[model samples]
Target chain A: MSKKNEIIVIGDYTVTQLEKLSEEFQTIFVNKTDDLRSLSAASRKNIKGVAFKGHRPLEFDAASFDLLPELRIISNFGVGYDGIDIQEAIRRGIKITNTPDVLNDDVADVAIGMLIALSRNFLNGVNWIKSGEWGKSGEMALNRTVSGKKAGIVGLGRIGCAIAHRLSGFKMNIHYYSRSEKSSAKDWKFHNDPVSLAEEVDFLFIALVGGQETSQFVSKEV
Target chain B: MSKKNEIIVIGDYTVTQLEKLSEEFQTIFVNKTDDLRSLSAASRKNIKGVAFKGHRPLEFDAASFDLLPELRIISNFGVGYDGIDIQEAIRRGIKITNTPDVLNDDVADVAIGMLIALSRNFLNGVNWIKSGEWGKSGEMALNRTVSGKKAGIVGLGRIGCAIAHRLSGFKMNIHYYSRSEKSSAKDWKFHNDPVSLAEEVDFLFIALVGGQETSQFVSKEV
Candidate 1:
């Protein structure tokens, strides 16, 4: 195979994604990130790049990187790259790329969508109409409105900012908690802590990136 | 009963609303608009005002209005007053009051909510998780995104304007069909007719008031 075709896909990819990638390159599939360790040293030496996309945590620390000597880069499918050890990747001169801001619009759309869904009881409303209760039992119980309510975002990153922008259209009072106050978030109240953000808002959205740094950030107190 | 206490409630009212009105005034309840014909002339003479609320069309034209000689006002419970004949009410020196702008926020919220729900297939996504299909079937089918899509409003009325304002947050390209272009809709593309508006948009919102004039505004062609 040509050097350009020698790529290893290490992660759980959907069947469609897997099929597309497999057809276009000399791709080696591995179910988990650490499965590269089981590959023979000669076979691993041919791997020039890694395409990783999975829901689980990737074990691509120093030990894992040492397994593929010829690997030049690790391209992550999602925005968050907390799974990979950035420090170790930098020391070994391997480039790390993540798809950032690509899903910001989508994530924000879902955040606002879920807020309205929960407040409006859309699922229950659908069930009410489908089960013939709308005609037999009259209208469904009145649901709370999403407009003019207060919403707080835990981490005002790209996704959080997108959500806040969308909430503004609903005439909602926007509040947020972030490591430092963002200059872009004009007129939106900023809280120094998550608990404070949680206290004064009708809905709290956690937009923090996943990892040890933010795993327990929104504790039981919040 | 005092003159102020004499009120007739026409059309369907919730149990709570009926109880509250009954507690405060000498109120006669009629199940529908035409049921006013059943009231005795003596009983109708005591009715100074009418509280109207129903899902069906109100038959409160000249013939129906003449039944209650003492009727001074018809207070509609909702924003739409298409069912009541405004010209007839004016000729009889009777006032027609509707609760307009009261539901602008709520109607706007549901408009955007239903948009997101349909585009993202939220109900199916919820069922996927609830039916253990998320674990068994992996991920559900990918859904279309709402942000940046073209949306057309059939009428640029109060409720349509509210829906348009909310759609702006989703980064949608707003196109609207109105009788006349609105000064308030800054930069939103205006179409002179519904068919022209429908041709260019992904989602079409029928926000026109329900009545003979606009009953078939969005016809088979659209």
Candidate 2:
């Protein structure tokens, strides 16, 4: 009952994303990667494109690729494409695309937020106020100051650069670790390794891309 | 028996602060403004410098000023001195001083953190992971993007300017409201009032100095 050239959508997407995909293609939706095997043979054969929408490692090796013989593309929704086995896709002439730089600001914002929340004891302060302890206790204990402190960023990618930019406003001395030094990030101090970066700063922020290359990157020594 | 020459310490200071003060002066520590009356007349006569702490309005009016005829200085611990009756202090020939520019970075960091937490729905996302609902639910609902949005700042002072500077990293269009436009903040758009600033931006950060002048500055209209 399906079309001959429909697209396959893997992972749990928002209703809007699903609706948009539905309007564009005769789509086969699967909530989990394992559900792909359960799809009818006829449906799998007709799959031409796959839209991936989750952070889970999508093991699209040669075996999974063989199931969708007509598959030409795997478009990932997020910036990281580590989930997909790129070498395997390349061998089979399958083109892979991911949305990069789209979430840099959001990711950076979260990094800074978490940093401030931790240094400022925001949770404890909020609880103290909500519990009516503020009125009773007179004044809360002073928290650690955030600005003019040293901050280290792991993996100076798009998100890391954005975070460093934000920290500049706080007068923080920026230190970062990346494979290669970025020419545009001349203002910040570059560390050849994560250990040096961590040792030099009061706060360490990890912004590395998720994949085998970065697995255990922040190891025991780091 | 205490020394005739001593400092009057007001408010509930930390033990460390009290210890430091004790080393410097023969101190008369009063937790509350009301407790000033309980001081012995001998101790009252000896008081010269008053280290004022906390936000409670220090009612150093003509009547209270009469109590401490020898009072020379009201040194405020924090930047804002709204609690102290400045006019009465001036009339009584008392010098006043406060620590400023020390807390700008911390306050601005907190403002940005709260904004990100709200826009990103960080609390819900955190709860989902901590409650083990992430394994069951697959993924939480998507949150609104924080960057490339508009931000309004009320009272473009030290903290407000710092917040605007941080938002600029997120590629946000900055709009601010202040009585007079700041020369340094020329890059940002300035609104005559808070109402217009609120209307133009997705998020509004208030960084006004607390006092009678700005008591209801961010009113219903804003």
Candidate 3:
């Protein structure tokens, strides 16, 4: 039979996703990034593209990349492609793509939710009620308020901007740290450095892209 | 000495609050609403007002109101005065006051937080991470999204308006049920009835006043 490898899907994908991908392309399935090594030379040669899913690191070292000579592009399912070797892909004339802005709203919602949860001690309140402590002990202790508080965004990118937009409705004073101030920053205060941004705000949200350069951008010092 | 009674400070009062009230006016301290009957008739005659605190009901029946003949006003410490008998207070020429709009923002923040926590299954995710299920079972099953969803406010009062303002940032289609269309409700759809509003929205927020009329406003049918 002919090699069934126009595309290789790497990492964990739902059955529906796998079926849809197979219906759309000639595909080979691999459970992990390192599984590419097990593919036969003929099958590897037929693989022109990779569809990446899941959060696990996709370490495409030179040796790993060399295994698939016909590889042309890697389409990452999520916004972050930090695990992928960008310089190696560029050097090998391989294209890298990611689904950017697709998750901005969901991510921003989570960020706001987490912020409110922490500020209001939602888990503790739930636990208090569940454990019958609330009935035994009058009321849960009052926690801090999120609205009208100061908030800082570590990276004023698409996701950070989305979070800042939501915080504005809560009447928060927005501050951000970015390499350069964005026009969208508007009335929000911009701090050129993360340290200053962290010092000035009650809450700091880290939204920088995941990569070696940004791995510890909000470090211990910050 | 003159009768030291311009106000009867009832229910739980912090030391600081008791001291503040003492400094402001001649005050009589009563631990409970029923304790009003125990006050000396001479002392009760001098009481002109009441500083009501705590969640316990301040039942002002004819007999209770009759205990303090000079009682003119009940200044409640919270937004809700459901426990105080309004009709009896009004009939006795006694005024009832509450701290309305003081907690609108905080209340709205909590409402949104609870909404996000339920929609995103935040408590379950926390348990998954804590129980180490995330490591063994991969990802948590995806939950519902709050953004771009329809939200209905049962009462478009101050707190409800604040919630709608925040939900607008999430791009939710705002719908409200109120006795009449509020002038402040600009683009939001107004439903004269709560049942119709409940039918059309993904999330329903009840901000109605707590009393007999609204006790079961969002009941089993909703």
Question: DockQ values for all predictions?
Answer: 0.77, 0.69, 0.81
User: Which lDDT value does model 3 have at B96?
Assistant: 89
Q: Across residues A1-222, which tens digit of lDDT does each residue of candidate 1 receive?
A: 564487889888889998888787778899887788788898898787999875555467788888888889998888877678889888989999998988889889987888888899998998898999988988899889889999999999888999999999999999999999989888899999889889999999999987787777878999
C-alpha DockQ for predicted model 1: 0.77
Local distance difference test values of all predictions, in order: 0.87, 0.84, 0.88
lDDT of 3 by residue, A1-222 (tens): 664557999988889999999987898899877898898998898678999874656575678789888889998888778667778999999998998888899999999999999999999999999999978887898899999999999988889988988998999999999999888678999899899888899999999887678876777978
**lDDT of candidate 2 over A95-121, digit per residue (tens):** 999988787777788888888888888
| Per-residue accuracy of model 2 over B1-222 as CA lDDT, tens digit each | 565457889886889999998887878889866678888888798677898885767555567667788999988888978778889899888999999987777778888888888888877887898999989977787788888899898888878888888788778899999999888888899999788889888888888887778888778988
Estimate the overall C-alpha local distance difference test score of candidate 3: 0.88
Worst 10 residues of 2 chain A by lDDT: A54-63
Where does model 2 sit among the CAPRI classes?
A: medium
- For each of the candidates, the C-alpha root-mean-square deviation to the true structure, in angstroms, is 3.1, 3.7, 3.0
Once superposed on the true structure, which residue ranges of model 1 sit more than 4 Å away at CA?
A1-5, A14-29, A37-40, B1-5, B14-43
lDDT of 1 at B86: 81
Who wins the lDDT comparison? 3
